[model samples]
Target: MKERMEKRVLVLNLDHTPVGIVNVQKALVLTFLEKATSLVHFDYLEIRTVDRIFPYPAVIRLYEYKNIPYKGVMLNRNNLFKRDQHTCQYCGGDKRLTLDHVIPRSKGGKSSWKNLVTACHRCNTLKGDKTPEQAGMTLRTLPFRPTLSYFLAEYAERHAAEWLPFLEVKPVG
Candidate 1:
């Protein structure tokens, strides 16, 4: 099956400071219809705004906006494995890894971020067709969907380190 086009949220800031990213559809609508100005970077647009009037127009000012394209979903196997550095969840060893359904598929485990984990060949084979409880294995941490902010922070940390100074991310803990 063909994969669906991934939608992105645009990160915006006023007065060269951090704000939040809005859905691309919303951003575009605001830009085209609402006359929201776009923030231009070297070659890419860093952000766009819903409001256009500002103190300055040419330089990055209080009314200025930038767009940071939205990154993919965070805290899935991609995020977990990225966070875990691709080590086997069961052994913490560097080896070939596969996805383990925390709840076995036979038990109505749907393929989703909350239901999948990284496992080594041994763990996957040993767990075989059985639930973690049945296999006598325990998960180190429960899987969950990460909030948009969490993923945004992660994306900024990895790709746009300089953005940290501009963005204010509220601490989750």
Candidate 2:
């Protein structure tokens, strides 16, 4: 029951654009207060009260359009790891991951999304103090800033498939 309650519910705007994610408790409150409507349910889950059982809301949409600002995803260690799918961009290793600058900071590369990538300890050491090209190494994927939809789509794929249809970014092959 506790674990189930921890599941996140997708919140969408009146126009069906994804706005944010809320825990089940907050989602229930919004629905009960008529601020939002449930659009999808987790068929295998339910919320039980003293005498009633409600279908677990997997997605909800607000009754009114909330003018939410679109702040970009935060750049941090965790987000960087997520963007790289936890694999080394240089060698594709999944362990001992570290951040690597495609262009070393020694050469004035800023720690921005385009300049950073995930690399294993070995790869980082091998490419130390030099750019990938200078070290005769190549990145498997170019790093880029991830949009909210990109991160949301990724989470939806793993924890909430119901949110997938409402998310703008679709899964690729």
Candidate 3:
């Protein structure tokens, strides 16, 4: 029961755009209050009360479209690694991952999404304080800013396949 309650529910706007995620409790409350409707439910799960059983909502859509402003994804070490798919951008290695600046900060590089990438410890050390070109190293992929949908799509692939049909995620490749 505790684990089921801890499961996240996708929340979509009236227009079916993903707004955010909520815990099962919050999703149920929204549904019970008629503010939202469950669009998909976990097939083998159900919520039991004193005298009622409700389908476990996997996704819920609100009754009205929200004018939520699109705040871009935050630039952080974890997010950077995720954006780069946890593989070293220089060598495509998946282990000993570390964040690297495509252009060394000493050379006027800012720590923004476009300037950062995931790299292995070896690659970081090999590149040192020099740009990839200066070190004769090349990145496997160009670093770019990631959108909310990108992260959500990645999450959906891992934890919640039910949300996939509703999301408009472009392939990361």
Best by TM-score: 2
Model 2: weakest 10-residue lDDT segment is 164-173
Query: What are the RMSD figures for all models against the true structure?
Result: 9.8, 2.6, 2.2
Which clashing pairs does model 3 show?
A: none
Q: What's the candidate order when arranged by decreasing TM-score?
A: 2, 3, 1
**TM-scores for candidates 1 onward, in order:** 0.49, 0.87, 0.86
Instruction: Report the lDDT tens digits of candidate 2 across residue range 1-173.
Output: 99999999999999988889999999999999999999999989999999999999999999999999988789999999998999999988999999998988889999998999999999999999998888999989888888877899999999999888988673222
- Predicted structure 1, TM vs. truth: 0.49
Can you tell me which runs of candidate 3 are displaced by over 4 Å? 171-173
Winner of 1 and 3 under TM-score: 3
The lowest-lDDT stretch of 10 consecutive residues in candidate 3 is 164-173
Evaluation by lDDT, superior candidate among 1 and 3: 3
Misplaced by over 4 Å in model 2 are 168-173
lDDT (C-alpha, whole model) for all candidates: 0.57, 0.92, 0.89
RMSD of 3: 2.2
Residue pairs of candidate 1 with colliding backbone atoms: 15-62, 46-66, 46-67, 47-66, 47-67
Which candidate's lDDT is highest? 2
